[model samples]
Target chain A: MVQIPNTPAPTKSPAPRPVPTSADVARLAGVSRATVSYVLNNTSAVRISEPTRRRVHEAAKELGYVPHAAARTLRAGHSRMVLMPTLPVPAGPLYSQFVHDFQGALSRLDYTVVQYGATGLRGDDAARAWAELRPVAVLVPSPGIGPEGVAVLKRSGARAVVTLSPVAVEGARALLLDHADVGQSAAAHLYARGRRRIGVVVPEEPGMEVFSAPRLAGAREAVHGTDATVTELSLAYTEESAAALAARWRGLGLDAVFAYNDEYAMLLMRALQDEGLRIPEDVAVIGADDLMLGRLLRPRLSTVRIALPSGRDLASLVDRAVRNPAAAPESQERFVATVVHRDSS
Target chain B: MVQIPNTPAPTKSPAPRPVPTSADVARLAGVSRATVSYVLNNTSAVRISEPTRRRVHEAAKELGYVPHAAARTLRAGHSRMVLMPTLPVPAGPLYSQFVHDFQGALSRLDYTVVQYGATGLRGDDAARAWAELRPVAVLVPSPGIGPEGVAVLKRSGARAVVTLSPVAVEGARALLLDHADVGQSAAAHLYARGRRRIGVVVPEEPGMEVFSAPRLAGAREAVHGTDATVTELSLAYTEESAAALAARWRGLGLDAVFAYNDEYAMLLMRALQDEGLRIPEDVAVIGADDLMLGRLLRPRLSTVRIALPSGRDLASLVDRAVRNPAAAPESQERFVATVVHRDSS
Candidate 1:
């Protein structure tokens, strides 16, 4: 054995420094940063030899190089993230359908959808908290939130602010889904079906002010151009309350009812039936949101189908607005609603 | 003008170096580091003078001593965040109720709820992604995920992994909610009402396996224990499908039908009535989830009401488990289901 003079050299450790960066891979492969980027992103614009690609791949494998998400975000400036504030209002199948559509649409547009839990947080506080995440857009369910909150969110780097409300906000693009139209349409359908006195079910929940107010307004609006009178009846979402409403239907002189949504409509209809009232012949009933249960009824519940704007369209608009913050604010898009005639009405 | 620093002995600035630190407050208010911390944290054990407290607060305000969240988190060693993966199932009113109750329960326990959008991710990929956030617990809706996924989540530092599934994983706690019970109850209700031939509405959506399968199974289980025979019908949630089903209701010879949930139930009922079929007389219809619409239907929809475990209990258990990770894993918690008999059935 030849004895060699001891020269201090670094030992090759089994465990290497875990985090390998793109720069390290580039250095090992002897490639330009742009070439590596192009290859990594699968950009067809750059032309690289197969051998070169192989070398780059081998170097990346040897070093365990992975791109940093933070670095990518920093470069992009804005995240591909959409912040949806959780509505405190109870979400039903109708709202759920809308949400599902919205999410699918946004995902197709390559926008990451995030639903922030905002049960307790009020307007500005919720906005401030949401702003911390720096989302590109925020879709509010247009119930409790207003323009001031939208302004705060816009200031926090949100480019597109859209809300579903009866009235459009100043800064935000509104998907103005008129709840009044739902009521008006239902009333009109019932009226056409020879329903004279229409009873409107009012939910007795604290946070239902936004939903109830617009519906009442719409009911009044529909009756404004007709001889049919709309009577607002407060009812808790309970069997007893529904039973009470049904029992008093004869005394109220109401021939038909325009319940807020299918849920309320179903409840009132049941109570009326239990009270020995023959639907359509004695008391015609119309509902909003055109739920499936309405169709399964004995004298199927007639309903106003409030058509929601296509989720794809809304999501596309948000994407475009987010990309170009300088774009002029767009007006609220109104969707057309039609009444679906059934046995009840 | 009271400048006595002609020799440049010392310099004084009104604003304390922009951002305030504990040392700056201690020096300004003439208090120890420990005293300042006690006052700032509002520790009742400490008996600091009111005057000193005021001075310290003034000093902090002058110096702009905003508490750093990251630094605070670092000191705490664990996050107060609870991660709930978004349910892939199309949401409804029943889900909304659960979410509202769950959030309320969690908030009372001082846990911040965060809903993660889990559309594109599943299994280990989802676990690794969620784990990167370092959440203390993860509550996932069952069916879309499996046991391997749960294990992955557990390995990722999630202490309490609770899923709403009958299938339990090795390490995680399962909160089994028997959806089959909902189906069984709804079917039994119809049977007791003297309905013989029962039709179960199965949604023909591609991705609703988690929901539809369980409901179908429940309906099957109920039929198994009864004289009534269960007939499975594939129904797409559309006007066309409902109409078609209504046209064929007489041919099927079904006296009663469980339309999965209230939405489908309402849809089917309307369609049946459209074809001149009377509910409860021609076919008694029952739905699950006891949605508000069920009550609002003319002959209110008879439904199965599923009672989820009280969120307060779950939150408390989660908090305790998180605090004591070494403690034995909690036993499975079960939810109860019952029938809400109304006019439709």
Candidate 2:
């Protein structure tokens, strides 16, 4: 067995060979192309002979013909893509976690999460661009898209048109995250702590205005008719800007503040400290989006805890829409926002 | 324009209309489907009359038909999805910004970024699952994939196989990010500061081990036959864990530590401060990924700044690979990692 005939050992290139398809499987199985498709897809309606089914499976296995998701999607007149229009803001941990979980759930349900850059797209034009991809579903931001855009998406065969807001779109399912609740909860928490002169720091960044505007409005609404007063403060995310605001802290005379989110709260906290304002005595602060870093603060920052729907629930909803196609629009359910009072407030 | 008294105003539903195809445009233009496609796509190889091109454009515009990306991909026997197997770790700001720019670049180039959830998948099975989507390109993790998996993807129509590491994989392009450089840089920075005893933090998390192991190896290699000593420390992302490590910090006799990344560094920094440790006096610390929050810390954090390729460059490379499949593998160019000194270290 040691020394045989003089022959060269065979080698295989790393370059991949052409893959087998359903057509190849059908030819090998001695069946029609329709039969191959039916067997592979397990078409529940059409009955196939047990022997024919076995042959199709056997041939598919021998040729390594996995029914391609894209090809199958084409046959079904849809794309497997679930387009998530990227939000303008750089996603922090909370949003990142939500997306991560959602991705996991969708993957388990067999859908690809395609994050589309919609920063430059607006309204129907954005919808048109999105439609070009022929995505089966789209998770669009409510602020950037409206009824016309939704119509465009629907026309392009998007089965599930879900909006990222608490108010339901005319013909799409709403994920229903009410930012007002975040502001309201933070303001209410500060009020309960006996801080009446409240200040809401509205971020001056371009993309953040969508969130900051509603938050400020909600805070103002929460304080109306009450002893508390809600004042809006404009702030940018630079140290110089924070320092400038801190320098004029005494002139504003706000006792309590609802910073937009934890990041802003942290920024303002350092600034206020640099201005020599004592917490609770001079100013009390509460931020939304309860982040882990907030816990590491000296006085431990108080925050508004956001409760989002689990990935499994959202994924099931998308899958249902994809499967059922059309159904009566369900009423929007508000996500919960509760106050977590740490020493900062 | 005023509305007519007798005529009812039109309403648009969110549901989209069926998209028009090349055949529809051809019928209206009184031209062949091939002529319509060539004219619409601006196929330079085929010459057409100016009147014919104008007719095709007018017909397409009148019908409100834009050439669908999916239909074209189907014609080309490929999917526009560039599958990115998601990492197990929660995305920090560094990863988020990188992905954001990458997505923007890809979208501008008319490619979709499909972030596939591979937490539940491993090895060849994961590749098979990814292949089902028939992504034109794949950015796979080094540890999770192998040569067979790369082969599977190529066979399934994935035009480019790229790894996250700089080290080349069989038949795949690697996006060179060497963890050794990150470790060496951090350790070298600490050594230059005259800190002989250094502690390297290895996060006690499931997904983080892949990074932590290499970092530890790199640190060990950097200190080999040197006067400096590198000690390994296990830390979880919990307040209690950080406090426990801080409690033993005094006994460990370590003057400097290179925490895995910014998140861990921030967490440990707070714990150390709480335990009455003075920055740079009792112990100095450094982390990687120059996140925005690190700049906000009281004694501002020092970090390892990773300079990744511009998204435009990376996207064009991917597009080039998709366009030309049989090209030779390009030489690996290491991503630059440099130390950024601040108050902490």
Candidate 3:
């Protein structure tokens, strides 16, 4: 074994107390180490007396003994960990809600959900980093994980490799949520409402290109072979950026706009209103994600409501994939986008 | 040795490809495993030739070899993981922004930030679950982590136990962000505006009680020894709930309301407006966490501007604690809340 130099001492306690082990718990409880393991790990396969279990639990509590997950993984050869690499951008309420539901569902399925912040890493580098943890499954919510990354993860003992991407990734189960549909639906709605000079708000925030690029492409596709002209308007999430965009709005001469999402749309709409632009009369506005705050606005913002797959369903899919890693990778297009018409358009 | 039965096979690969190890990379690169480890782990103490390093890296990439984090921890006796238990509730923009920034800062400091979903676990149980991962540090953003929990984490090799709570937790470094201050600032601002009957919005959402209860107490504290009376208004985040509350607003006979935060304020404000109740004229409204969308509202929402500690500053504190675990626990009151008077109030 290669000696690892400069390994920091694990415990920095002034009088470092030895970590209580199962053997200590067993000695305290007057039971065998196997009995302590069965009790502490809650091995349902073996039945231990209730009083004996209580004794083991009491001893563990008294000694502050908790099983090390890493040690357990090393021994068991697998862990019930579902690694979700955290995206770089701040998750909006819509995304947060989905994550919350997904986590709850995954928890119910007895999987420990872990969100690892792999900020600077991408593709194979990121996959390698995640593989080091030896997670049973990896649910990547971004587009950077290529086929090579999927292969690396599978080779490193990942039972399931799932990706929420615009297109199917080789050797991975795809939770295809095409963002382009959101832009298409919004653009079509505006065009149907007699809007010809169309502008699309592309958020200038870094790491938003994965979603915004596809949405922009969809908007261009919707306006193809039509008199409607599509213009790209770059706007940041800040109020100042919205104001600056609104200040030069008249020069762009766009009659309608499909802001990337509700948050950006709300920012731009308020700026345009401050600039004496009436809602649909001056410039029609539409956004995607259909956030609740959008409906609270004065014009009752029009939006393309995106329906994501139920968290429970996704959890079940993951569970099934984990049970049968050899099963053919499933590609399901569960994303549905429909225009929710309100007063704005 | 205690036998662990029912241990699942590590990999379910159809053709079961063996996981490439440092030894495999060394063999392929015609070098010692120590050389490969030094090059891969970037151990600066031992220098290897550039050509040898390139060969080792190329072999690692070709064989998809990744050093096991668990194995490394076993050898080093510690890890560079900072565990943050994921909160039960969906994070709002303000909280999400803070997490994003904190994760980025921690990443720059070479700490792997991991958000573990300990949904059903609480207090000591939650700490035990986190300690099982053997994280170097535990940053609890919410309450429920007690002295016992701190002890449990520290005993399991956590060098730093940091908490963002209203009060300092025993035996843990405190990032004191009192939620009550937010409510007090808003209530004081409204009371100063000559509004006597104050209504404090308490969100009905589960897991929000930790924040809402403290804020409610603070509002009541602000109104103490005065004619102003504080009433608890339980409201969910949904627009339907806001509309239902707004429908019976006149019956409550409240002169002003301190909505939970800017999101709740905006939601309730729109509902009240829809009910033909002019803001500030009929009932002055104030909220906390001065969100940007609050400024975009027609009445320009008056809010308690909450200034949280810089992510970099918090990261530095965590790093300091990790480096010097025996140092006295630090308690810093970095949360500052001040009311921003706007057109709404």
Candidate 4:
């Protein structure tokens, strides 16, 4: 048998190395500090010799000297940062795609996009946390920020405060994405298909209530005075949960179901199929968010296709808001929900 | 019909408002500026009356004065910010969950988490941009940072530079998450199950080469010195692409396939079924990343489940590195890939 050697003890801490500064770059380039600043910052107003500019840039690169963003902000009294608060739960594919697009668009406009994780804080506390960074703009999700939060951010020098909420928020630009319209469109389509006793699925995931509650209310509103009845179905995004729900399908006597979204719909549909139920013939089903995977199902899933303004369009709106902080805030209806007909319903 | 009025012309910019400062709080609290700073900043070395602290807090709240993060960093010579560079591509569910978990863990350690979107930048340019913010730590993805980039960041006062890469970086702590293991596990499992002719999928998505290329190579490595053969299949993440590939499957004469991931596997499986080819009988299919949707299919998917180091463990590693900047950089293997046998294989 081979014997292992003992591990060595940790060494003492090394002495600190001095950080490179602009002065070092200026000395290396044989130029004045003012000249180095003008060349590095690209101050077009003050013209400098091309050779001098090149020398300054080369020296800075060799020294690995970078301008401090905090110092620049202090001098300019503003930052080109657009702050976005990350949500507590993981975002689905659709929202993730939108965020990527938005970031790309903002980058094109010379804005640095920063996502701050403001978990365990809400409303005014969250806003105060964001204000500490002194971002030029703040984009928040619904129920995370209110009028008081908006006031706090603006007081800390934020030019624009925007919210993606169901209703318009006072003192902020509102990008209205009401979940009710999605449920209304899905339920109305089912009712038109002559399916009665419809059930609406509510996801049991935490942080989903902000969206699921509005959808449930909208479904109830669709069948308020009609002979068709709407029933609430609680489901989780898991195979076991879906199988348990499908096992009692016959007792519920429902003719159709509107799963929360395409993911939940796929889960429930598979479970129902395992329980020996026929699609459309025995129980019709529909879902929201027309994901690509929905079409892979044998009976292609019918869904509510939700449309929001393009990321480029929203970026342009934010730029306008930042430029004109004194102008009255605008609230636009941005949600367009429509039903896509398929074999599932 | 109601008459519509023309839109109003744009208004001129309004007068700028005066920003409140700590002086205003001091005046409101009827205390000196030094006392206000000690009370608000919670200076442990100084002793103050409880009633005085309450008065300072009430005054600050009324004035809506927030200490600037930039100013505090200038004074402290360091910050509690852990900067992460956001990837260009939209992250999948597994990665998104890991990010949320990591952020939560970092927040619990009293560190502020900020994700910077460094679009249109690479290598040293990206490092220079991040260094401008003076972050205490930076966590970057694979192929984004190199030895020179790490040196630049260290010179700019970054205490911890970590990278999630397949191989260990020269001067940074590396969290090794090799994609090759995922493909190797899947291919080895298929070979053990009597699969002879195998095809490995490579996604055509632009930013996916960093992951797909290694996986394809690993699959080839698995079939070396055996009677089995490996073929490469190029595919896009779309139904049309899958259908087109499936249309030509008969001429290829492949008996088994290792799809890039479960999402692509589902798409290909559906297309093959539409082409009248039965799963496991005509061709055995296996995928990497055991997603939940894989089990919902008619024939449960066989996959390579990848286990990564927990977020809490990574957070602790970062904290230790930050506290001991002079210590030697460490690299640890953080990926464990295993195959889950199911009906498809």
Candidate 5:
């Protein structure tokens, strides 16, 4: 074992006095502890006169009383929470932006968003770990967990389990978002633009197989369905990787490339330009996830636009499911994907 | 008084008994309640041997013993948590990505990240509202909360307060990252590329002034130090805003624009291209936060590379502060900014 260096001792004293409790507020308001609880929680049942409610509110205000989240969770069974398990991915711009929007939308509905860190866990273990907190719902982005995992979560009282994967689980509601559609849509648009040869970007990341495989499959599906021939190109999301890919662009003889998304498209586009390849004239490029900056390019890059199901819709579904655990599973919904054509394609 | 309509009630009976608690785990493990708590919490004072620990762990695992969060909070006196109060402005891709990374880093150190819904609170009131939970720290984005707010939190037992503002609060350790530096760095690079009449993007969203103001200030500061002048152009993230801004590109007579970041830069770039503007020649564009897709543009976008302090460094600092609250306030640390030159500029 490595010997640890001695650290300086801390000098700070313990904080002054304990935090004021709801009992203090109840005493000050001259009401039963239950009455204070009901007034403070704004519960609809067990009516108190307006003035009495005002008295409890005033006492709470004077004492700086905020309901304890932990105590509330204990009484309420589960938190008014939605947990999204996050993995570190090279999300680039568009996907990152969508996540930001999703968070803001969830906040508007008074639901707390908890991003559970599940870095090393996989499958049923990951699901069981997540279910430990008793979240109302779990939104898994390309879930590594399977049917057994879903069963574990359901048994633990997770009302709704939504995965952004094409494959549906036995016990959970699946949001079957076909990533293949994004890749297919990009390829189809490029093919229609009269490009015979296409390069599909394959990200060189271990976990991206979850996203990249489906996208590649979709691109191949589109290419095989048409006269266009598709070539797979493995590229890591790095300056060096993009430069190397650009250096070999001439040898590949591809007329156009679907660079996965706006980030990869921009990366390769710059490298190709550095290699003296004029976009559209020498090569046409398309990206997916119509990011905000795609249009800012010299020749605006064409991209695939994916619309997420509205936050209101998802939140309402979660609320309903939590209230009635035996309710029938909601039908799987697939969000629409469309193409936004610009100059590069 | 408005009469409320009766809602359809649940048709099926509720599930048997509540989620198994710590008491249940104790019974399953055939251990005393104190022994179970000691093993589960890994309390060092208790000399429970390895076999005893294993037995307790297995029993808790078999019974699915998730500590009731509320009960734990009540017993612990304070939460093992941090609260981040977000403004109404959408946390675009770059900031959102940083936040995600920050959360990951914090989780590694055993801190639970809670994004509080602070929309209805402001200033000192926001601090009071957050203090109700007795979190260990509060991280407010730059320009979101003020000094009085920080003081309120300190009085409420928040040991550490971190903010992204240029100004440091009296008691909090400020991670002073200047947003203006981002725009100035981008503008300086654009000017070096012989582009004149720079356009600075100003987001039209109600709450974006916090970010946009600093960026514009930085751009103007750089331009004022030279012969060029920055034209502040208001653009929202919406398509309509981009189209309108793009349509009047020629009227502004700007040869280059410093977009706030990759997202807005991409939005305006697309709009400009749609309106038939030649990138670099007609209107060179530069964005901040060197996103992966910037290079994928027809002419790669030049950007300001913001060098944020490592998450490990920040977390370690926070932990130290928590352990020693009376330690002299850490001197404000400022991160450096540099320009990443690409084809667009």
Candidate 6:
């Protein structure tokens, strides 16, 4: 029963340790834990000296210390979650890429972005489900939330309720992204290019109606005084549907088309080409949401480009809404979509 | 001082109520809050009658009482999150749809699926970030994680660590999805259809090497015993790359191609068509991942279909692993990808 005595018998290199904690930073800066927290979180109520704050910052950076999000949420009752409800629609590569960018920005702001599934939920039922998360902020996309739902969410202590839709929701701060602008820009571009007969593609998928209906209305508005006519063409993402549409392309007497988005436009365009219609020569085509695939197309797809606010800007808005709470709830830009002319048109 | 004599005189309808809690369920079920919690959560260590459990369920259903996730996490340390780290690869519609289904299934099992942004994180650092949430389980896809990362996660109380790849990581239960099988299947289909010269598309995008390299290797394996030649074609999603490939198409002299996936296939298809090459006549094309966009092409795309285990099955497996932590790890099916035939090849 001999104990291993603490003697300087051998010199061995120490194994790699973990990331630095707040305590480590505080110890290094010769400050208290409260001061470290105050400096790190920018707790304005705390009157820490300038030199002390600078020392804390330098220590934190040197030690590579970052605050743990969950622990912070637990201690403060102010959650770091920015929960984006999963939409019913199958997100294309473009939307996924945009979401990825948003996640990166939100993470930079020390918010943990959580994507929650809300496929068939609506009204207060959906609100109740989201409230279970106790998120600091919730960013909802179209098939925009109703007033009762917003009230429920607000009651549940969501500091920032934001909707990304065509119009602003009453109780939520919003970024307006009207599909009508997309249709108007595309249709107007085609009309300016002197294409009189226009077909507006409406995807037959169930969830698309929210986005497509307004687009159709906008397309109709674009051709109001002109000899141009806008006809709603229902199409699905199946081979049979595309073939049927391509089969009747010549008889429809359409010289140009605004195909809801790049995906649909690419589908319709490929079919038209197979049906022996030379793109932009026999029938001009335009799409919305300028995707990378659009460029690889034969005639090169002309698309309505949505100029979304940068991720940093959106993150800042969320932060402002949470921090201030009483700020005005509106977008600086009412519309973000524009026409990006390519070889197709 | 009268409050409308207990409100019996008025015939007005009542206002909507707030989100239901366990108290409402307890009152309805004629049980204590502890009994209701025990019955609803199936707190196995506590004894409760079947009739009591039924009553609790009925009461909860009637009131639409959902357990608050954060409160449950705080009380029991049984986290609801099945955290999937964001991979470097661009998730197309297929993966997004799959994830959406997974989320729905996991939610039905009272697990919240959270996607964490780990764009630049790796090893223990990434594990530490994920561990901060204290998720019950984590489903990791390829760029196989290290032992240190697994140990960090396990030490932080992750009950289950699952990897979706051909190669299993130590200390993690693995679901083997050998993407190479997809390539082999696609190439074999082309060879069986009498196409000798084959071009295998390898995406030039940074993160794509994880998928594309193995696929190319498998394609070569499919033609090992034959005179058939497999050519590796480097393609990017850009228009210029497609154009450049189209310009050099005449010199490659390939009769067939197995593109990495549907997105890349579609991009190349349009370019080949623009270059005046006839589909299946001058060149045959096939791609892995049966994306919906593929079907709309004139010569409907042939694809390698990777039949992933259903979300419910995956959820059950996760639950099983958590309940029986000492159980051996194994996949029911080793090869997930199957070849789905269509007109393009």
**CA lDDT scores, all candidates in order:** 0.72, 0.82, 0.90, 0.87, 0.75, 0.80
Q: After superposition, how far is residue B323 of candidate 1 from its true place, in Å?
A: 2.7
True lDDT of residue A2, candidate 2: 81
DockQ of 2: 0.30
TM-score, per-candidate, Cα-based: 0.73, 0.84, 0.94, 0.95, 0.85, 0.75
Query: What tens digits encode model 5's per-residue C-alpha lDDT throughout A1-345?
Result: 865679665565755645567799889999999999999888998889999999999997776566765567667766666777765553544444445556666667666666665245678776776775567777777667788777667655677787777777776777887888888888888888899899999989667777778888888888796778989999987989989999988999999999987777877888888899999888999888777557666678888888877655665666667667677665575767799999998
| Candidate 4 local lDDT, A1-345, one digit each (tens) | 765668566667877677788899999999999898889878999999999999999999888898878877777667888899998789888888888888888888988888997457878888998988888888886566878889888988889998998887789999998899888888888899999889999999988988888898898888889998989999989888999999999999998999989999999999999999998778888988899989999799999998967878887888889989998899989999989989999
How many clashing pairs does model 6 include?
0
Q: How large an RMSD does model 5 have?
A: 4.8
Give lDDT: candidate 1, residue B13: 25
**Total clashing residue pairs per candidate?**
30, 4, 0, 0, 16, 0
Q: Return the lDDT, model 4, position B6.
A: 89
Return the interface RMSD of the candidates, in order shown, one decimal each.
Answer: 7.9, 3.8, 1.5, 1.2, 3.7, 7.4
Tell me the docking grade of candidate 2: acceptable
1 or 4, greater by lDDT: 4
TM-score of chain B of each: 0.79, 0.82, 0.93, 0.94, 0.85, 0.78
The number of the candidate with the highest DockQ is 4
Cα deviation of A121 in candidate 6 (Å)? 2.8
* Sliding window of 10 residues with minimal summed lDDT for model 1 chain B: B10-19
**Fnat of candidates, each listed:** 0.29, 0.49, 0.71, 0.66, 0.29, 0.40
Q: Can you give the lDDT of residue A55 in candidate 4? A: 99
Tens-place lDDT digits, model 3, residues B161-255: 99998889999999898888888888999999999999999999888999999899999999899999999999998989999999999999998
Write the residue-wise lDDT of candidate 2 on A1-345 in tens digits. Answer: 786667755443355677888889989999999999999888989999999999999998777676677567667778777887777677878878888888788877877777666346677677777777778888775466777677767666788888777467777888777888788888888888888989999998877877788788888888789988988899998888888988998898889989899988888888899889987578898888888889987778999998877767887888888776667556566588999989998
- Tens-digit lDDT track for model 3 on A1-345? 987999875755577777788899999999999999999899999999999999999999999998888888888777999999998788988888888888889998899999998458888788989999999999999898899999999888899999998989999999898998888888999999999999998889899999999899999999899999999999998989999999999998999999999889899999999999999899999988888888888788999999988777888889999998888998999899999999998
Q: What is the overall TM-score of model 4 with all chains considered together?
A: 0.95
Interface DockQ of each model = 0.16, 0.30, 0.59, 0.63, 0.34, 0.20
